[model samples]
Target chain A: MNEQSITLKKKPNLGRRIGDEIKRNFVLYLMAIPVIVYFVVFVYLPMYGLIIAFKDYRPFNRMGQGGIWGSPWADYYGFGNFVKFFQSPLFWSVIKNTIYISLLGTCFSFPAPIIFALMLNEIKNLKYKKIIQTITYLPHFISMVVICSMIIRFFQTEGILTKLITLLGGEKQNYMINEDAYRPIFVGSGIWQGVGWGSIIYISALSSIDQELYEAAVIDGAGKWKQLVHITIPGILSTIVILLIMNIGSILSVGYEKTILLQNDKTASVARVISSYTYDLSFGEGNSDFAYSSAIGIFQSVVNIIFLTIANTISKKVTDSGLF
Target chain B: MVYKPSIGEKVFNLFNILFMALMIFICFYPFWYCVTCSLSKQADTASLMLLPNGFTLATYKDVLAREAIQKGYLVTIFVVVVGTIINLIMTTIAAFLLTRKNFAIRGFLTWMMLFTMYFGGGMIPTYIVYTQILGLEGSILVLLIPGCISVYNMIVMRTNFNGIPTSLEESVKVDGGNDMHVLWHIIIPLSKAVISVMVLFYGVGHWNSWFNASLYLQGTEIQPLQLRLREILILGQTAAEGDAGDVSTMAENIKYATIIVATLPILLVYPVIQKYFVKGVMIGAVKG
Candidate 1:
């Protein structure tokens, strides 16, 4: 009787459990039907379009049937596009610029928010805290286009920022067009726009920390700095790790629009990152080398995926926190 | 009990308050500059004015007098309102579905959303799909459909939905109310704060969008305000660049005028929606 029951249990294993779940939640699945269909069409299907990176990518080849994936010349490139990218003249420049900008951002942009959150949390006055938070929060809501315009204008030869910089012995010309200035400008603007928004999560995390810990520490004669180090830092360490992992994973992705707008021939060597590069190559001369452009994009996404996986695995192993 | 602070604490507090005030000034200065330049006379616009000096509505008149700007404003308003409603419906229903316990496909669906967040077919493939396959090029639907559901926003909505007590839904179920009824009454009422914040977020997204319009709806009459703003601000054009390319005083004055006009609505709406955004983030993050 025991053996028979064990055999029966094996029969109702993982697949059977899933089948039973499907049967039990039929109505719930119905509620999610539209979203499922939307994801299938808009998201999953386009992911298959990444296959075009391997093909010659003729519209005619894709037109007959199977659409974006079933191109007649699927193997025409056969890693050729990726190989061409590696050998391309602009390859090193794009890679260098992308890494430089992203790393710069990861260093300054990531820490500014944490520091701001810590500072804001230290404020004892409620009114001053709220006013400061509100003022800082306003920048994140401003449109990127507007932000880019502001940056451009502020760095103009005669603008206020340029005036300040010139007083510090910088040249009296448009700093926006300076190739060497690209990384600094990009990182600076990123900090200005993102620090407040990024701080929100940390601040929220801070608010949820038990007040009794601080009270206890104070009763034990722990100073504010000691209390912050022992209690506050530990309180929000998990949030910090998760956000850091996210930042590291997305180290490859940057805003394409702002980059494009900011980029002219003057700063093209240092300014043209992955997304902007793909955008430029999308409709180049002589039949819009779709294969080449898609390959460049695939190259970017692959590196990003690699970085993301590394980040996830490391965080999961070390801090027991990760996105997956 | 309030703990007494040391002298070091008092000094720190004073310094922090002053630092915060300076930060606030830094935040407000650009908009202040834009407002002043837009309202100032052409000669006065070049000079740095902390306040609006020699203020006039002539720049506003010139900016509004353009035909494309008017059309752009109308289209932007229409898109933001309609698109946000669609976003709310999709997000709410999806969130509710995600929150359903013992959902067999929940894992699958969540993975799908997360995967999309990390990867995509890039812009060209999406462009081809819209233009060649879907035939949405040059249509306003291009703007609306391509970005109908933002994954980040969807996750926020789902997190909020998960935070709602199941007892509320259970009570509705005991009364013989189905999924729609539970969502319509229990879920929607409880989620007013998140929904409102999502509305503002989606509205701002639609308003600030000009890239898709630049790519797909170029030279169309239904171009959005941000595109028009980009033309004047970045492209440095006057009267949409083609109708009249007066690249001098009128362009300069109208540039700031257009910035103020395009951004003023958001500025006004921001304060009202600001608290909701903070609350929304807090609630979503707690469960996240």
Candidate 2:
């Protein structure tokens, strides 16, 4: 019996071991079946559908009748759609607008939360701080449609922001239609909407900071500004770095919802972004070039992946910490 | 140990107070303006500032009387309730499965879900798959089913689940109970805080989502409140521009009333559950 057991243990079959595990946890495996099927159908199937980027996909060609699989191949050796996008003038403008807006977001909106958190940290009055936090977080929960509507209304010809602009020695024009105002409206509204909610993580990080560090700083004759620079900033530096890396990773993926809601015919020239442009090409009036839009979508995803990888690598090298 | 403050610090403190007050104004004014403008009479909307000039509930009465708004409210309510239920169930199942340490293929499954967070099929392909392949065109199921499970939320839920001591789960096993019993009795009961957070996240997501509705249910009567709000507040704005009359003035009040109506439920509900959201953020930060 000992000899037999030794032989069985020595040459354990992988299939049998897997079978044994499944049998042992039959209920657990059964539970996992739905999730597995869900991912396969909703996620992987769509990924498989990405092949249409290479094919000249026609909706009229139903499945089993020259659909995504059976459609004619795109020109330029399956790179025709990408080639067309590259050659189009809309490509440059959208690319420029996307990068411009994303960069502005990174520069202004990203730091606004950090600064707000730092300022909140300095407030010793707890009740006042709580009140401020509660009020500020309200906008983050407001729907994009409502926020964009408020933005449009406030920037109308006789609107509040227009009046303010005129008071500041500017023309009383409807700023929503002005090409110059799109970026500011987008970025400013984003900061207003996000600052409070975004600051929550940083606030928690600050609280986790050891109080002894601040005491030591105080004992070292550090002033408020000095303590902020030396103690507080360093305390939340890692959180900031991780969040920054993530922000950089998703730099190209400016949410298309707000852009679609906010942009009109007058501002479309300046406001057309990659995702919105994709939506327009795919489902816009009289425009159903699925292959072309899919190519553009693939372009955005590829660049986003590149950006994420680069940011993660640089972060790991510089700070010895990364999202991965 | 009491420390004395410097004169410079006193000046800075005063400045900070004023700055915070300004921030409070900026943050609170938009909603306040909406409330005041919605309540103001048609003639008083233009000159409105600080407070309602000619207060009235006629705008809300007029806005709510619209057939489209009523339908939109029903659609959004159904979506939020049913969609959140599906979200919570799917998320709980996925999170529970992923947290099973000895579960075969757990690592592979986790990696599979995580990869989708980084890469997706993008707009056109996903659209084709949903509308053409799945035949969900103009169907509300398109909104409900596709986003039933957010991988990020699932990961957060899994992280929270992992924190529950294995001893508790083992006791259920000792009582001759199975995985479902342990989940239903122990795991879920102990994770109510995180689950509430999930509900809030998914509920707000469904409530605010308009893009998918616009894409999938365009021109349908089943559009959500946000989409209808967009039509009234944006498209309608453009159509009504350069006109001067009581008609346009009333239209302006209707826009404000629409904003308030669409946003008030969330505004009222959020502050009560604000702590859970903050806790949720903290949990997410732990994973980050």
Candidate 3:
């Protein structure tokens, strides 16, 4: 009798327990169906379509049905497109431009917010700070199209910025078409749009630093500069490190939207990055090499993942904090 | 104890104030210039730098009178309204379900959603699926359907929902309330701040989106305002572009006017919603 009771007292198997849970929460499960279906169709199904990166995908084949499944394996055992991309002269220039632009952005745009937040924190008057923040944050809400339009207008041959340059003894020309001006313009505009908004996180971090520490430092004969160097910097160091890590991880993902809108025929050589190049191959006028573009896309995604992982690892080693 | 600043500190403070004033001018002047130029007449626009050279409402009237601008506004408004509603509903349901600790498969479902944030089918493959296989090529549904729920926003909402006391949900459950009732009464009421933030984020996103529309609906009549702005502002395809008449000289004024028209709503509503936006950033920073 005891043995029989022990056998009956055993819990149900994992599958049976799950089945019972599902039955018990059937309403919740029913509600989840739409989200599941939406993800599967819109997100996961497209992931399956990523396999065309390896295939010679032809959307409008004359001789056969045109689809991912209908495509054949690429040359060199499915490495043909990537190999072609690597071999092309456009590859190095594209990579160089992407890195150049991103590095310039990191050098300037990354630090702008940190400095702005630090300076803003120095202002004792509340109303002045509020007004400054409000005006500065407005550009972030403006549409990229509008911002780019403003940029184009400002840099036109007869534009305000051009006139200012002429006043400063520079030649009168459309600076937007100048290759040398592209990186500065891109990075400068980015800082203009993002600095105020990005500073919010750091400002919050700064505010959260314990006031008691500053009081203690003041009592200990530390000057304002010393207090800032020792107390304030260390307090926000972790926030700074984390944001930097994230920025480094996404170093290669300079979005093509602004680049596409900003680039003209003259500056295309400097402006074309990995993403815009992929866009051009796939959708630019008279070009529809799906397989090639997909290969490039996959390449970019993989490199980005690698960068993220490396950054995370380094951050963990140095700062003892990481995204994961 | 009283504290006094050194002479160096006083000079630094003065310099900082001047620097801040310069920054404010730099930030405000661009939009101000746009406004002044938009309000300026055609001949005055060339000399229109500091202030309104010659004020006129004709530019606004002309830009607004264009059929394309009117249609663009209608399409954008439709997408922003309908898309945000769909975004809220889908995000709310997802967040509610995922926050239910007692719900089985919550972990699995959360992971499934979170994984997409890291890895996504890059643009071309997604385009193929969206355009060829799914047949959303020329449809406005292409914009509204595919981006129904931003996973990051859903995660933020889920975080907010998790903060609501479980006892409240349990009380509703004891009253024979189902998941929907718990969401309606307990979760939604408690999470209004986050929901408003979500609405702002999603609404602005829909309003500013042009790349996807440009890709899928290139030649479609239902192009959004930003895309239309791009055509006129960037590609220099104003209604006056083809004509060699005097109206062509007003192209710059028209472009400036179009920008103001497209951006006015956001600027008008910004101050009221600014606090919520800052709050949203704070909440996101907590997770980060």
The prediction achieving the highest DockQ against the true structure is 2
List the lowest-lDDT window of 10 residues for candidate 3 chain A: A58-67
Tens digits of per-residue lDDT, candidate 3, A87-186, equal 9999999999998898898899999999999999999999999989888888999999999989988887778887888888988887887988888889
* Chain A TM-score by candidate, in order: 0.85, 0.93, 0.93
Clashing pairs in 3: none
Residue pairs with backbone atoms closer than 3 Å in model 2 (clashes): none
Candidate 2 structure quality by residue, lDDT tens digits, A254-291:
88988988888878998999999998998888998888
**Candidate 3 chain B superposition, TM-score:** 0.93
Better of 1 and 2 by DockQ: 2
Among these predicted structures, which one has the highest lDDT? 3
Model 2 lDDT tens row, B1-288 = 788899998998888888889899999998988888888785243343777767899989988999889999999999999999999999999999898888888898899888888777777888888877788889889879887989989988999999999999999999998888889999999999999999999999999999888888987878998888887788777555534332344467677888999999998898898878888888888777
The estimated TM-scores of all candidates read 0.89, 0.95, 0.95
Docking class of 3: medium
| Residue A285 shift from truth in candidate 1, angstroms | 7.7
Which regions of candidate 3 deviate over 4 angstroms?
A: A1-8, A13-16, A60-64, B43-50, B237-250
Candidate 1 chain A vs. true chain A: TM-score?
0.85
C-alpha lDDT (0 to 100) for residue A123 of candidate 2: 92
The per-residue C-alpha lDDT of model 1 at residue A231 equals 98
TM-score of chain B of each: 0.89, 0.94, 0.93
